[model samples]
Target: MHIKTKFFGDIELSTEQLWHFPKGIPGFESERKFALLPIEENLMFQVLQSTNDSDIALIVANPYTLVEDYSFDIDDPTIELLDIKQEDDIFVLGVLSLKDPLETSTINLQAPIVFHTSKKVAKQMIINDNKFAVRHIIGSQPSLTKEEA
Candidate 1:
């Protein structure tokens, strides 16, 4: 299937590539289906493009890459919903909030998108811990090197 995306423009996707967000991301409850498209020339980021709407794309990355100490627990509800069977079955990603200057960009560490790799199901799970911020500054975080960005 061909989808018209906001960042990547039109691209081909298969049913297997479609991720089913049963509850959808917050503020986008109606947009359930999404595809994680790789951003060419940049391995650190990926585009979470909505198959339903072209304007609903989000730039996402593995929070662990930016914040090495980043850690969160998946609630039982989300585990059951996504049918997460084992530790290796699940992977997490954080949405990136881009700014005019790339260094000022932030990532929403408070809510990480959890995915069940085998099931292809995902949900944006909000962490209740006060240690994380919704707009965690990416540039100031540890482990991000000049080459990585």
Candidate 2:
């Protein structure tokens, strides 16, 4: 289907690209559907574009790329919401806040969007851990190889 996006403009998205967020995201409680669009030539980041709203798109990346040691447990409610069965079933991604200088960009580590690949279901889960911050500098950490990313 052809849909207009905030960053990518008009584009064609296959049904497989669509993800269903049953309860919607925190701020976007009504925007439940999203399309994960990858940025050209950039393997580290992707645009989580809201299918229902043209103006809603968030830059996301695998937090593991920057914080290799990052770890968090999914609460019982989220586990049931996403219907996650196993550890390998879900992948986590962090929403990024782009800055004037690219190096100063920060990622929201406290809340990571977890995607259940097989089910095409996703949820933005906010971790209650104090160790994880809402804004974490990106370039301060070591980079990961494509395989790792």
TM-score of each: 0.91, 0.92
Over 4 Å off, model 1: 140-149
lDDT of 2 by residue, 1-149 (tens): 89999988999999888999998999999999999998876778899999989999999999988776799998888899989999999999999998967778999999999999999999999898999789988876543446666
> How well is each residue in 1-149 modelled by candidate 1, as lDDT tens digits?
99999987788998777999999999999899999998777777789999989999999989998986888889999999998888999889999998867768999999999989988999999889999899988885443334666
Question: Model 1 Cα RMSD, Å?
Answer: 2.6
Residue pairs with backbone overlap in model 1: none
Q: Evaluate residue 24 in candidate 1 and report its C-alpha lDDT on the 0 to 100 scale.
A: 90
Total clashing pairs for each candidate: 0, 0
Task: Report model 1's TM-score to 2 decimal places.
Answer: 0.91
lDDT of each: 0.89, 0.90
